[model samples]
Target: MHRFVVIGGGAGGLELATRLGDAFGARRRNPQATVTLIDRNPTHIWKPLLHEVAAGSMDPYTHQLEYAAQAYWHGFEFQQGELTGIDRAAHTVTIAAVDDDTGREMLPSRSIRYDTLIIAIGSTTHFFNVPGADAHAFALDTVAEAERFRRRLIAACTRAESNDDALRAQGALPTHKRHRVQIAIVGGGATGVELSAELRNTAQVLSAYGLHGLDPRDDIGIVLIESGPRLLPALPERVSTETARLLEARAIDVRLGERVTEVAEHAVRTASGRDIPVDLTVWAAGIKAPRVLSTLDGLTVNGLGQLNVRPTLQTELDDDIFALGDCAACVWPTTGRNVPPRAQAAHQQAEFLFRAMRDRLSGRPLRAFEYRDLGSLVSLGHVTAVGNLMGGLIGGTMFIDGLFARIMYMSLYRMHIAALHGIPRMLLDTLAHWLRRRTVPRVKLH
Candidate 1:
């Protein structure tokens, strides 16, 4: 019997595990194989929508998948624990003990043996060791963190609204008569940029609902600070330029070429000595694979702490071991560039590995994974979206925006839903979610 273990139940890992389990798990009674999925969290939330979670535009609880329930219905064994180490010689992975929210021990450390192992633990925020950055800035890596940020944002606005005189005296007024709650966001990547835009929409929605006393238009100040010259540096220059223009038109302060040297309690200090007052500071700067990657029992890791893998998605040192998603540094064979860590990439890799696993079980030749550049999309809240889609006259990417781009952007999440829960569940859930949204507040206030 082959014991297949997949660690880290992120998008790629969860999908792969569900498919593999459905194929070989007890429902089918395939005595030749067993599948298990291990993750620290009891539920799974799509990483891409985290910014929406942080900005209170979306409630994560409504979208999260209960791993235990998913496993029961889909035929995979689910284990909850943090990955601590891997034993290459014995083909075993060690999971650290976990405690409940009250600090009571729930489970002890254990090791699981596997004939085949897939590691996709995902990445964490890389603070770059900036002074006070880790201590003062909020990183949206988990649901809890996102919810915390949302609460802080609301609290900041509420406090500012209640103390207009103090704000006016402190020169926190955006204009002659209104005070703005200044939010400092570090990094102009998709998370930072999207959150900035979403927050603007959140302010408007909050104000219209009378959730706060301040004027949304005049009381919310957004300062997006990017060390780079423009936003979404990973994307095309045109996209970045248009995005900047859109942000500026919405009264957002896009500060380019200003590196944050320190994140203080109430402000962010830039490289050029400019101090930006901040009611809330969010650090969406950069990411690195979890530090546990470095301790993964002789696995070779790149500078980003990602496991080095061949095009086959097999770890360089061990064929029995494989990796995918943000944790794997797999170079695109055609472009000689490492695959960019994107949700699209993760989704594609999951599909590729699903087929690869079946072949391995049948002792067939495994095909190498090829990454496709499907272009990128950036959503500007409910207003619009901008992105470049593949398929043009010369086979180059074509820039797109407005209503069409928004539809395309939405389709991405719909696709992820379809991948995870199948078309029927995805469709039903979509309708249910739409109905629920009409009855609830547009943004989460608590």
Candidate 2:
């Protein structure tokens, strides 16, 4: 009986685990193989949606998948623990004990032996050691962090309004020019751009709740700061230009080529020694693999802490151990560029590895992982979206905006769901969410 364990219940790992379970978990009588998934969190949510969650535009609970429930439905065992280390020689993974809320030791620190191991622990925000960034700026990495940011946004708006009221009661000019909550979003990547737009939209939604006469275009100021010369530097030139145009039209101040030297409690100091005052700051700049990856006993990692994997997605030192997603450095065959750490690339890699694992189990040669060049998409809230279609599907460099790009961006998440739960279940969940959305408030006011 083969024992397979997948670490990290992220987009790539979760989907692959579900597929493997469906294939192996149902057969009870014929010496069925055991499949287990381990994650720190009890639930899983698409990482890209963290921006929306941070802006309070989407209810995360509705989108989150309970690991225990999904594991039960898909016929796999779900272990609630964090991986501390792996022993390749012993074919075992050491999991740290999870301390319960009541100070009880629910699960002891233990080792689980596996015939195959997949590491997909994902990445975290790279602050670049900017002064005060760790203490002042909010990062959108986890559901908890997003929710915290959302609450802070709402509170800032409320506090600004109250401050204005206090000045009014003191017999000052009614519109005596008080700055509203000014948000500074550092990093011009998709997460930073998308979050800025979503925050603006959420401000509009929040205005109805006692923010009388507050003009989104005037009172609420959003500044997107990028160290590079243009936004979305990784995307095509046209995509960045078009995106900048759309954002500027919405009254968002796009500051390009400005390096942030420091982050203060209420301001971001730029390399040019300009201190831009802000009420709320969000740092979406850069990313690096989880710190744990660098310390893996027999793994070689780059400066970014990403494990160096072969073309087959297996660790260079161990064939039984594989890695994917943001934590794995998989080289591109043609361009010689390591594959970009994007969700689409991770999904594609997961599917390839899934098939390769089954082949290896059946005494067949594993196929090399090939990366497909899928152009990027950036969603600027409900205002607009921009992207370039790849695979020559829409010809060379098709710059799409408005509805088309929005639909394309959404389909990416839908595709991930389809991979995990099948098309029928994904469609049902989509329809259910749509209907529920109509009856709920746009923002999570609570």
Candidate 3:
């Protein structure tokens, strides 16, 4: 029997493992392949939702997938470990041991051999070596990190409200002079834009709960700083312009073409030597493949540490090894551009690899990967959404907004759920989520 091991239980990796297990690992009597999935974390959550989680607009636990349970249900073996290194000559991967809460070793370091190896170990936040960025700015890269940011946001709001109460008691000024809480987000990408909007809604929700003394609309300030001339540089120019308009209408301070030179303890310093004081700072500027990729035992990688893969998504030097998602640097031949690291791109790659791996097992040729631009959507909490749809009925890209675009934006995540848990489970999960929201606070308090 062929042994297949996939490292990383991210969006692309988890979906690939699920499909492969359903087909080959489901039947024990005549199994075509022994599928195993390895991940550092015990659970999986969609990476894009990290922004919502950070803003406390969404509870992550409801959407998290337990790797052990998912693996059992889908007929795949789950191994909890992190990749230490890969031995291309030996066709094996080294998994480092995991420690328990008390720092005791729970799992011993081991090596797993594979006939077919797929490396979908996703990317990490790239700080660009900006001074003080790594220390002062909060990054939403994992569940723990997002939760930490949410806590800080809650604390900042509470502190500001208390300060306002003290000022009022001393008759410093009228209620019109509201206490202000400032947040500085560095980046104009979807994560930064969406997070800013979500944070605004979060402040409103807190005010409604009597957690803050000042009016949310007047006192909560969000400043988005982008080095580029516009936000959402990857999307259409119109989308960026309209997004900027909407954000400004909500009173968000949008600073463009202002590069952040450094991040201080309580502020963001821009290129013009302007020190914008902020109570909370978040960095969502850029991404690069995990540092482990660069030391992958001679695997050629780009400057960003992404593995150089062929059109077939296979590593340059190894035919049996494949990669995708944020870690693999695959080119879009049509546009002569590296495929953008978007959820849609990851979904497309996973779908292609699903067929490609099956073909490999059956002694057939694998086809090349193609990145389809299904357009992009930036969701402004629940007020509205903006994006374009590719190859619409009008024969070209059709720009859309409002309710229609919101539905389209949501369907992207639903599609990912379907790929992992099937349509029936995905629908049930969605319904449950909707019902749960009605009974809980709009935003997490603690």
Against the reference, the lDDT scores of all candidates come to 0.90, 0.88, 0.90
TM-score of each candidate structure, all chains considered together:
0.96, 0.96, 0.97
Q: Give per-residue CA lDDT, model 3, range 1-446, as digits (tens).
A: 88889999999999999999998995556778999999999999999989989988889998899999999998899999999999989989999999999999999999999999999999999999999999999988999999999998888888887876788799894554423788999999999999998988898898899887767877888999999999999999999999999899888999999999999989899998899988889999999999999888788999899999999999999999999999999999988989999988888898899899899999999899988887899898876888888854347898898888888888888988999999999999999999999999988999
TM-score of 3: 0.97
On lDDT, the stronger of 2 and 3 is 3
Measured by TM-score, how close is model 2 to the native structure?
Answer: 0.96
lDDT of 2 at 188: 98
| Displacement of the residue 268 alpha carbon in candidate 2, Å | 0.8
**What order do candidates take by TM-score, descending?**
3, 2, 1
lDDT of 1 at 197: 93
| Pairs with backbone N, CA or C atoms under 3 Å apart (clashes), candidate 3 | none
Q: Write the per-residue lDDT of candidate 2 for residues 1-446, one digit (tens) a residue.
A: 78889999999999888878887764344535788999988999999999999989889999999999988888888898888998889999988898888989988888899999999899999999999998999988899999998888877888777777788898774653535779999999999999988887888888776544467668889999999999998998898999899889888999999999999999999999889999989999899998988777788998899999998999999999999999999899788889998998889888887798789778898888988877899998864689888774655666688988898999999998898788999999999988998999888887
Q: Indicate which candidate wins on TM-score.
A: 3
Note each model's CA RMSD in angstroms: 2.4, 1.7, 1.7
lDDT of 2 at 251: 85
